[model samples]
Target chain A: MTDATPTFERSPDLPPPASTVGVVGWLRQNLFSTWYNTLLTILALWIVWEAVPPVISWAFLTADWAGTSRDDCTSGGACWVFIKEWFGQFIYGRYPIEERWRINFGSIILIVCAATLFFPRFPYKLWVSLFLIFVYPIVAFFLFSGDAFGLEWVETPLWGGLFLTLVIAIVGCVFALPIGIVLALGRRSDMPAVRAVCVAFIELWRGVPLITVLFMASVMFPLFVPEGLTFDKLLRALIGIMLFQAAYLAEVIRGGLQAIPRGQYEGAQALGLSYWKMMILIILPQALKLVIPGIVNSFIALLKDTTLVLIIGLFDFLGMIQAAGTNPDWLGFAVEGYVFAAFVFWVLCFGISRYSLHLERKLHTGH
Target chain B: MAVSSEVGTPPARASFWNDPRIRAIIFQILILGGIILFGIYIVNNTLVNMESRGISSGFDFMGRTAGFDIGMTLIPYDEASSYGRAFFVSLLNTLLVSAIGIFFATILGFIVGIARLSNNWLVSKLAEVYIEIIRNIPLLLQIFFWYFAVLRALPSPRQSFELADTFFLNLRGLFVPKPIFEAGFSAILISFLIGLVAVVFIARWAKRRREATGQQFHTVYVSIGILVGLPFLAGLVTGFPLSWDYPALKGFNFQGGMTLIPELVALTIALSVYTASFIAEVVRSGIQAVSHGQTEAAGSLGLRPGPTLRLVIIPQALRVIIPPLTNQYLNLTKNSSLAAAIAYPDLVLVFAGTALMQTGQAVEIIAITMAVYLTISLVISAIMNWYNKKMALVER
Candidate 1:
């Protein structure tokens, strides 16, 4: 064994070859990996080249950005001057000029409340959120539909544009969430009768288009109500929207509920907890947390559906644009008005969707 | 041990009031009672309201003349037509738009979906940006943008932009050469149908042959040849039974071609673009759900990338893709109701809007429109469910 012993050789380490490292290597691996991929890269570059320059020129350099009238739009580009001129109408839509401050105040309150509730590390957020949910609507109602506090009464008919869109979307979402939770629970209840009723409610709403629902609310709801007693148009539309959205949200929550293991329910029962107590303490929190992404998705859907209010003769954000577009003064500026509306809608919806995706990532602990 | 002992000992029975069963029954009874009362009240009030307001409610109004014009109807419609005919026309139009949208959206979605997974950084990023931009915006907003901004921005009929000699784009809509089938066309049509059947049989035989023996066939090229070449041969033998009607400027506007109205084009384009984004996401997720091990395993077997993808990955990816794809189709169909906004004369606009307006039967008209949509949706879902079951892996 001693005679067969051999010495081992060691080589000093060298730097990685340039072909497998650095920016050039990344380009080789990701962009120019194959012949077809290079072609694809060139094609994509062509598309961007064709699209971006025109958009830039139209949106920025050649755009009529700060003009009061159509005459100012002399460039062969987007007439952004239309948007600027009718910005107030786009925001408040026939809301009395003197009383516009009320909408501003409402917006401020909403922003402040949202900032406080959603921002992480805020103290007592849960309680504050609950308080806002339960009480803020009352405050907002009084503020927007002001008959109290010596303020002038602003009718819902005057409630148009972005303000009205937020009003419907926010109220629809706020009401839909709790109702959806209840419906979901009822659907999964041990009681067959409750389950049947909830199923019927959910299915009926899900089966029909929201436009039909809005039509029914606007026209048929009057027939349902007692004679000489009327419901506010916005309130009726809100009711229809809430019921419609609740069905979708209920399904989302039910997905979460079904995902929970059976052992959780059994364990809660073994702990001698009542159904409500079991749900509250051991089930619902987990289920709701699991479904936060789904809930937000449904909320985004509800926000979009809010635009359907236009059919019922309500002037939501989109409706306001249509109205402004048809104005004799703003005639031929439909392109600009619609583009502006799309941008606003795109921004809000995109931001919310991104936030929801972020939340999903953060909350995904992989049960 | 204490808990087990407690469980072992029979617990004292609670009073009936405290019993969950009795309480549930009582609760259910109360709910039933409330619902019944509410229903009766609504019915009574509605009847009284209808009577006082002079609003008639029945299917009888469906027979009355529509006395309204519906733009862009697939079926022939006029003021003299009954409400039922108008409904049918609008329903057909809705189905037509939906079918076209679904077809285009599926193709675009697959392209975008595959592009999102491309090795090329620029291609993937471009696809990602497209999906993100499209999916984030509301469908209604997109529809408006297409209808008002894009379509309306087109030049008038007199100054139409030419897409080749056969197609033209103008403010009124897209003017495309219309196909006109002359005498002896049935032979070509029959051959086409025969070719389709042949292709189906060939595909089945190919599958069986491949399964039984490791043999391959150029079934795709054969199928294409049979389907298209047979039709062309039949047409040639029948003295070319297909002719085209091209639009030419007559008087002030283009005449004699099939005009896809701006509304239909706008609706179809918007729906396809919006729904494609969702379908792309579904496709991306479905493909990703196919484990890398499957691809690596296929590679280890010396299978080429294309064959591995076609045989190994797609079968598995399809299971994940289909349910969500069906959902997007349903969404696209439902979103077609937005056509009412632009007066596209879809089911909602013609039947729910014009028909309801003329008849003033809100409940019946709305009910009929809803039932139509519900039936369409249910049928789609049933077909999708059947496909899903077929695609699902069989387990012992």
Candidate 2:
């Protein structure tokens, strides 16, 4: 009936495919394979539900959304009115009330420039970046603390909050990079004198914590240099932070430099490239490329470290939150304020990290 | 090359301006001059400023006695103590926190790393959530949260949570019973150490034998047996001399016990959680670096997953993981300095803050603090590097 007798192969084809291959199968295998996993999943969901509802309710529902006064809050939920009232102080610290518009304008300028740099579709990114790198500081300085151009001077002591955080992080990144590169090079240098000095300097900074360095900058740094030749407190702290951060940055860069094939340097030399030319055009371009993710991670770390300046009495983002939360009017909002600051910091740091991962995949040449 | 062997003579074709040696010498002279000038200017200006301010600065403050109170002290401390003693107490506190953080961070990191690679979706996601959240936020903020929001909110000493009548948990700290060892306990300790030495020797001997003869030896089991059994046996033979000093509830608070201050707890927890994220990545990457074929081959030989993991995968993975993990440990230690933010009397807070303020000896104090960290860091790196070299796969 069916070609007489079979060829004696049992089931012939392979056994039926197991139910653990595609999305549904993966869900079954991973999420519900064991009673334990299912239990864990349920527990996790329950935790999320429990935490999120209270948080949402506290932050939004039964909350004071509006009004100019502290009296608006009834306290069942987050008194957003507190955040609203102190929003200016959070943004500009003690920046002169009327003059605060300058920061807004400056932020707008930077935002437009940043849009050019961050979003790939924008044209003339080169010019925009260059403008951002060089010109923005001048405009921001004049607008923010202008004594020149007939605007009243805003002292740095009064200049703080989120603005300070942005300023420090940007300055730290920029100042740290070149100094870090030099230190990294000096560490790897053949010259005994240069190498020894750099080794001493980098190790000295990296060994201690940033908070101590900030303390030194605030109190002791004055004693190090000539007394009459004083730097602004913020400026001194900035320098200290730059130096300390540069030490770490230098080590990271050194790792990248070491990772590059030795032949790359020799090859550049073979092509008769000068030391600077070789570094700028050949060696660094490759070495830096390989270390982009590492560099981003370090930058994220620096951003987080900026909050430490609160110890030195600078009202950076965290400082702003602390000051506001501790004020007599909003005595019990410590949790809310910290959580808010945490959320902002989380968004920024997480964005950079995710972008770095994307870049890792995108720029991956699989050397 | 032999042509350049002419002693004390420049090459015949050398130009004065283009001479590498001369250029180097000139640059060095310029740098030296700049540094010297800068140093002199600073010194002279500082002296003038000091005179103008009518302030005389010296280390005289140290001998005058430190007029401050340190809440927790591992040493005998009083108002009569010198500033030096106070600084030491703080430094010890810092070391204690760093040590504890490194230990816990490593354990949590390993667990989370393994979890990240788990077939179970929920576990992996949880690990991811822990890492991404902790790593992104500033450590300072986390410390602040633990100190200000969490710890500060706990009930006062009056309503302190009691456990077993020997401990108390309040906003202040966790009070647990401390062991008071009898003088004769030294005999037990000495014997325990001897047991450790013997176990190490046995391990080495067993390893050599196994290598030479291709025979399996249960070294781990034997070592564990020696570690625990020998210690217990010694203690029993030495009259079982250790006893617990249970903290009595006295007045409003627990009188005496091993108190873990809230600041210390917060700092250690923050450090552990933050560094664990980095360590998790390191562990994950290291395990992933091993080739699938190695595991597959071992499996085909009828070896189980546990044996295959240990004999084939972990050995190779460790070579990759150890280097990065060491870096994370170093980072955790360094990050512990942030304890100053929450006023946890670590080296930075105590010496860098209180001591430096008293001494006004910025250079000396900073140099000392830096040196301590440098010593700790170098020791750790040196040990880890040596271990990494030893564990590196010896490939054909």
Candidate 3:
């Protein structure tokens, strides 16, 4: 005694929920749904208003973007003129005037190679990156140091500014990674004696602050060397930074190594590969891949730590600024100098972190 | 008693070339020998070079007078103080800044972390900007910015910016009214301490009651009342024995009040702001790691939002939060060494910088300084491990 048949027509689609359909609805739900949320929204807007406009006006509207000296900076705003006047020094440091072209060429090669390496669609990416990793440093060293290419010699002491910072960061990472891998392996080795030595070395470096290490290198390293052999302060700082960073990198690498399944090791052994060959060919590739984000993070940290070299009398990028800030010629522009330095560091670090995040997402193996 | 009585033939002796155990021993011995010989060679060279330079190395300089004046000291110190006292004073200063930094940073970090998770679009975005900007810049630069660019821009002590007429800010530093304890003040202190203990007991009792009888108690209000009322009552009985020592301009600088030097202020602010960004990320991740299913389950069980967070979420989230939080604290402690950059007279500045420079005992001074940091790290990690275990989940 039910109805003979049901209606075949579809029910009309209702409008989407009112709280999520439009911009106003979105605003209502997201910003002003509750009284407390509304208050927070207003406070946030006020902060933005109070902060952004002043910064814009100070940095752009009243900024002195022209002229060469401080006289051009009459406006009550940022003195971009001062930055421009010392821009050359900021980039080339105390490198000889005739030899600035070598630094420029070196930087140009670096930028081009880096751009090509990171370019997603670039051909021969592997070979290019390999070249960058292995050969470019040697070539760049000759270009910067000279005396081998019929170019004038530029001492390490003469290196400064962004060039020196990049040098330290790149060289430090390159040298540290292999040492870190070795130490990480040693820490995980079966032999107790090797493990103990590795543990002591890593901990000894990790326990102290980087500054004391630099101090030791500067003040005590000279005493450790034989007579008639002296280390450049820059060399000394590099060594100190390398040892310090290797400890941190070893820990990160160790974490990656630990993530590898014991089955992987067993498989490699079953293939009859020797221990070193197995690690080199099988274990490390996957472990390093897993820890790319961590490695990038440590590299960023090392890049920032290079500024500590200023304490060792090494005139790196930041050291140049600290020195130039005190210069009688550029008095009262410490704020500008520091702001520039901060901006440079922020950009580099932020870029590296963003890349790391991207790599992390891309390399999600779901293990 | 159940051991097998069957005897088996021994395996053939393995050759040394193919033996893993023998190879390991040989490898270890080689490493040990190399390390020792290299260590001796370096030591010999260092000693010879140091002697040639006429710079003797030992920790005996610790007892000698420091002669240098520290910018800030927690304990009494002067030019006449021994190097040991100076070291202690600087260590205390370091701990003081680190403690203050950690306290404020945790509070700010939690607020920012929660704000980041706020449904309010503007609030979360603003929090994001704060974290990104603060975290990207180096800590040393941030310290310099606060010290030279912001705090140094303040008016001189003679024209100090007064806050509530009790706190003053100037180029010299921040000056706040010192709390002066007078006769019978110990009574109020004792009452406060008693109130704290009572609150703990009340909390435990209330929790037990809630579990046993499905009843709720307003322990928060009760505890606050007890804490405040007991202190007030004790102070009244003790004739209100607290006074404020106001700072006054006697000459060029302020006199007769507690002064926090600009260096300390800058260092603390920089450390707090820099470290708070990191802590904020940790806190946000910790809270986020407590899955939404847990909250849903709590809600289905008739738990309100506050109880769901307090009783359900926080306990689990804290397990995730504490390990990283401890790391940030240790990092802040270590980063305090950057105080040497601004001449804040921290342990590094006092012991490693000045003490070493004066005595020319690089090896000894740096060793002690490094040992102190290592010890601090070890002790902190030990405490953190204990706390983590206490907070860890109990599973079969």
How far off is each candidate at the interface, as Cα RMSD in Å? 1.3, 2.4, 1.1
DockQ of each: 0.73, 0.58, 0.76
lDDT of 2 by residue, B1-396 (tens): 776675748658878887777876776667667878888986776676656766466656556688787877888888789887887888788888989999999999999999898777878888889888988999889888888988889898778888777778788788899999997898888878998899989989998999999888898898898888987888888889999988776787777768899998888888888888889989999999998999999999999999999889999999999998988888888889888888888888888788777666665677677777888888989999999989977789
Candidate 1 vs candidate 2: the DockQ winner is: 1
* DockQ-based CAPRI category assigned to the predicted complex of candidate 1: medium
Residues B228-252, model 3: lDDT tens digits? 9999999888889999999988889
Q: What tens digits encode model 2's per-residue C-alpha lDDT throughout A1-367?
A: 7898778766688744667677868888888888888987787678778877988888888787888767877767877777778888887888889998888889999887887687878779999888887888788878887899999999999988888898899888888988999988888876666777788889888766677678778876677665557778899989999998889888888888998899989999999887789889987888788788988988998999999898888999899999998899778878878887888899999999999999999878896
Residue A151 lDDT in model 3? 82
- Candidate 1, clashing residue pairs? none
lDDT (10s digit) by residue, model 1, range A100-193: 9998998888788788877788898887788688888898899999999998999889989998998899889889989999999999998999
Q: Write the per-residue lDDT of candidate 1 for residues B1-396, one digit (tens) a residue.
A: 678876796778999899988999999999989999999999999898888889987788878887887777676778898988998999998899999999999999999999999878889899999998888777888888899878988988889999777798999899999999888999999999999999999999999999999799999999989999999999889899788999987877889889999999999999999999999999999999999999999999999999999999999999999999999998899889999988898988888887777778887888788888888888999999999999999898
Docking class of 2: medium
Return the TM-score for each candidate structure: 0.94, 0.91, 0.94
Name the lDDT value of residue B296 in candidate 3: 100
- lDDT tens string, model 3, A1-367? 3677876899899998887869989899999999998998899999999999999999899998998777888998999888888877787789888889998898888898888867789988998888888999899989999989688888988899888888899899989999999999999999999999999999888877888888888888988888668979888888988999899999999999999999999999999999999999999999999999999999998898888888777788888888888888778888888899989999999999999999999998797
A339: Cα error in model 2, Å: 0.3
Return the top candidate by DockQ: 3
On lDDT, who's better, 1 or 2? 1
Error of 1 at B119 (Å): 1.0
Q: What C-alpha RMSD separates each model from the true structure?
A: 3.3, 4.2, 3.4
TM-score result, candidate 2: 0.91
